[model samples]
Every structure is written in C-alpha cells, then in structure tokens.
Target: METVTISPKYQVVIPKSVRRQLRLVPGQKVQVIAFGDRIEFIPLKPARELRGMLRGLDTTFEREREDRA
Candidate 1:
C-alpha cells in the first residue's frame, strides 16, 4: 500500500502509481466521504458518461402488499 503525508496546507498528493491506475487526470474531481474513522475518495463522473452503467442490473423486487397497488 502507498502512503502519503498531508502537507501543511491540508493537502495530500496522490501517488503516481495510484493516479495512473485510476486514470485520474490533473483536474479530475473526487467525492470525499468520511464514515466512522476512515475516509473514502470516489471519482465523480459526468452524467453523460454514466449512461447505461447499470444495464442488465436486477431491478425487480417484491413490493409490500399495501404498496403493490
């Protein structure tokens, strides 16, 4: 695993290998989420680029009786 130190300005530089592997560009945006203790960085994609990403996903599920109508 690669380690990075947060700079005095509260910024951390993502390593080169990690950047290349994730195909991250110089100005790409990422969503920063914090849960419990650790943080997660998720790359944000444009809506147009997200087209048909869930194709063939199982979307059918049983509904409750009262909600079925």
Candidate 2:
C-alpha cells in the first residue's frame, strides 16, 4: 500500500501512479468518506460512463413467491 502525508494546508496530493491506475483526471470530483479509522475516496463517475457497464451479466435469479411484489 502506498502512503501519503497530508500537507500543512490539509491537502494531500495523489501520487501519479495511483492517479493513473484509477483513471482520475483533473477537475474530477470524488466522494470522501470517513469509515472507522480510515478515510476513503470514491471517484464520482458520470452517468453516461456507466452505460453498458454491466453488459452480459448473469442477472437471472429465482425469487421466492412471497418475495414477489
């Protein structure tokens, strides 16, 4: 795991390797979350980019009769 130090301005610069791996671009927004003792950053992708992301997935699953609405 890579480690980063928070700057005096309360900002941390993401490493180039990490940024490239995540396909993070400048001006892209990320959602910050504080979970337990660690912070998490999730990239916010545009809705258009999500199109066909789940293509050809096995979505056929049986549901119980009572579970049907």
Candidate 3:
C-alpha cells in the first residue's frame, strides 16, 4: 500500500517503485475511471501492440445439431 498527496493543481505523481513495476514511461496516456469513491488509472496501449496477443487458444467447442451448418 502506498500513499500519495494530491498537488494543489489536483495532480498526483505516481511513485517511482510503482512506475518501474508497471513500466510506466513519461507521456503515456492512461484511462482514468471513477469507481464509486476511489479512482483508478489504466494504462492504454496501441492496437498494433495488442495484435496477436491471444494466439493459440483452445477454441473447439461442441455445437448443437440445429446450429451446425
């Protein structure tokens, strides 16, 4: 658990340790969400970087007789 103080401009600096762990670089955009009372920050990645991320998964499944074409 970490504590951070919000600056007068309503900005808070993410801690170095957390930043290093999350590989957060400067100028990276993050999606901020307000969940109930606490806020969350999710790092955004380019669609190109996410390509082929789910390769080789078990996709086979049993199909109903009427649904099969």
Clashes of each: 0, 0, 0
Model 2, runs deviating above 4 Å = none
Task: Give me candidate 1's TM-score against the actual structure.
Answer: 0.80
Q: Give the lDDT of residue 50 in candidate 3.
A: 90
lDDT of 1: 0.91
Give per-model TM-scores. Answer: 0.80, 0.79, 0.79
Q: Summarize candidate 2's per-residue lDDT along 1-69 as a digit string, tens digits.
A: 788999999999998999999999999999999999999999999999999999999999999999988
Candidate 2, residue 38: lDDT: 90
Off by over 4 Å in 3: 63-69
- For residues 1-69, could you state the per-residue lDDT of candidate 1 as single tens digits? 899998999999999999999889988899999988988899888899889999999988998899956
The most accurate candidate by TM-score is 1
The alpha-carbon RMSD values of the candidates against the true structure, listed in the order shown, are: 1.6, 1.7, 2.0
Regarding lDDT, does 1 or 2 come out ahead?
2
Q: What is the lDDT of residue 64 in candidate 3?
A: 92
lDDT of 3 by residue, 1-69 (tens): 789999999999999999998889999999999999999999998899899998997899999999978
**What stretches of model 1 exceed 4 Å from their correct place?**
none
